[model samples]
Target: MGLPARRPHAPAEGRARGQGGRVMAPFPKIHDLYVSRMVVMTVLLTWTVLVGLDVVNAMISEFGDVGKGNYGLLDAVTYIVYTIPRRAYTMFPTVAVIGALMALGQLAASSELTALRALGLSRRRLSLSVAAPLLVLTALMMVNGETLGPWGQRSADGMKTAAKSKDMAVAQFSGLWAREGDIFLNAQNGQEHADGKDTWLELDDVRLFEFADDGRLESIARVATAEHRKSGWLLRGVKRTYFEGNSVTQTEVMEEHWTSQLDAAALAASASNLWRPRYMSARDLRDGINYRKRNGLDASEFEEHYWGRWFYPLNVLALCLAAIPFAFGTLRSGGAGKRLFIGIVFALGFWLLQMQFVKLAGVYRFDYRIAYLMPPVVMLGVSAWLFRRRSG
Candidate 1:
């Protein structure tokens, strides 16, 4: 028999020659590595540009407040510096999706993506490769949100408050101030304290101004410390002075019970770093929710934030994945403007959808967890469909 007919060379779709001309498996790993590096670098560049712009705008706004009280240029700069982490954390999700889009768009423009596709890399596999870097970024952002973001925000607020208020009780931003009926209460400062398994708020140098119904000054009480307990609020080192026309009487007490409609948990939330629920960590949010619930307060807002924090990573990943399909389609022949527009549209749409769901949740009294999940779930479904269609 003649020598066996020479076998035809295999197509290059799933095989490549190694150093010795031996066949190697498809280069999915190499593609993944290459894509990951490009995505990460693009994300950092995007994050820097966006955050820098945001910080500049904030600095301009802060400068306008420099002349107020003791808030000078230096103080304003310090405040802005401290708030940078919070700003970065807040802008990350939007930046990440946009950056991924730009990176893939660049790849498509360069024809590298086309080569990868021709080499039998499915769109789904490519998307997964893109997702790996984004997932890593998402984890880092989550950590920043919980740690640096909250810490920086709290520190910035404290610095601003202190700089603006000398008396610490007269300024609006000084400390905790509240009104319950005819009693106006002010705390020079307040701090959250943890005792084993329990946590509570302690108000230092608490002052209570009891006004008459007709707006006359009736009495004033000063307490060295106000502590919130399970039973009620306890005012220690109390000194009460009564104003009865020309007659005045003073009384001193070791402690007194403060009976009012104010919830300690609510006060604690306000006292702890001027609490903006959006900036708080999930742990703090949970504590707030539990505290408010135990005191029979409406925990809807806290619950909303708590659930949102828990779902942040999922939302980010979904948005990033959803953004990739655009690169494979319109971005292949499009320029940076188109990529940016697509990114903005997706980011804004997702943001608006989330806001609408939150409003609906409030109006309909539904679980906020469901509301937070809806946007990401919808995006994920859309992404899956697009990948399938594109691959087909």
Candidate 2:
């Protein structure tokens, strides 16, 4: 018999197929880029709309107080501008889901997804492509939240306080309370300086109440100005009052070297809603927790906030991923508005559940780490199962 002739490979087939003779590469760069770009643009537009709505609502809410004190319309606008980053961080997860869903729904509606499926792109690969750009966005958001959000929030709050009350500008309470071993510390006013490693707090009118082992008041020290030094606190113009049986004695000193373990981290961490945990960076939260823990202070709140902020991006990505199946399955044939509305509904529910969980955790003394991780884990789990079922 004659030798069997070898057939030449088709040029089109060679170019279109993978090395293993599949119709698609493991990761198609052009397809991934196209999907990523579409998703990113949709997300940006959706996020802008959400932010605008929020801004309008905020302006309306603050309009009532616009003329009060020195807080004019301009001040309100400035305050909104300053706090934009924080708001963006807070609303990111919701807008991310809405945007991704809208993008996927659009593609499905246009039969682009069908074509991709025909080209041998699996759901898993497509999901990853959609997730890639969002991961980058989440990282950028982390940076913005850590750097710009805190600084801007602090400045806006100071401006609002100064406009509202004279005491707030100089001698008002910082709403910070901390316990260091046997001593309890409180500050009427404090200023934060720009120091990356140590959040320097320059306290004005600080009060230190000391207690004995029996929980009796031992003494009270009042300082006009207090700054955290390497060794301890440098208290200027200190007045010490002794609470002894049947005799109360008072002494004053030009300056005193106070030995205490509390630092700027503790003060900033203990600040009330004005300095919320979401504003602090990971490093800030870690340092604060360590300082407070080392000083025999409770760090539960800081730990909770730290974990929540640290897992923020992951939580958002999970929610977005979880939302993909809805866009492709039931909502695939729906209009963009329909998908967006559904996304909003889901986002609102997620926020409500998150808030409720946090509140319940605080009441029940649940583990902060678990409380922070619960939402993301559940979201991702559901997403994985859905994708598996759909693909199977």
Tens-place lDDT digits, model 1, residues 1-392: 78989977554534565777655654458778899899999989999999999999999999987987788999999988998988988898899889999999999999999988877676766888888888888888889989998888877876676566543322324456777888888886566778799887788778899999899999999998888877778899999999998999999999999876676765765576565678788998897788667756567778888898888888888899888887777889978888888988999999999999988998899999899999999999999888777767
| Backbone clashes counted, model 2 | 1
User: Residues 113-160, candidate 2, lDDT per residue (tens digit)?
Assistant: 887776656677688889999999999988988888777777777676
Candidate 1 regions exceeding 4 Å error are 1-28, 169-273
Instruction: Tell me the lDDT of candidate 2.
Output: 0.76
> Please, what is the TM-score per model?
0.73, 0.71
* Alpha-carbon local distance difference test for all models: 0.82, 0.76
- lDDT value, residue 1 of candidate 1: 70
Pairs with backbone N, CA or C atoms under 3 Å apart (clashes), candidate 2: 172-188
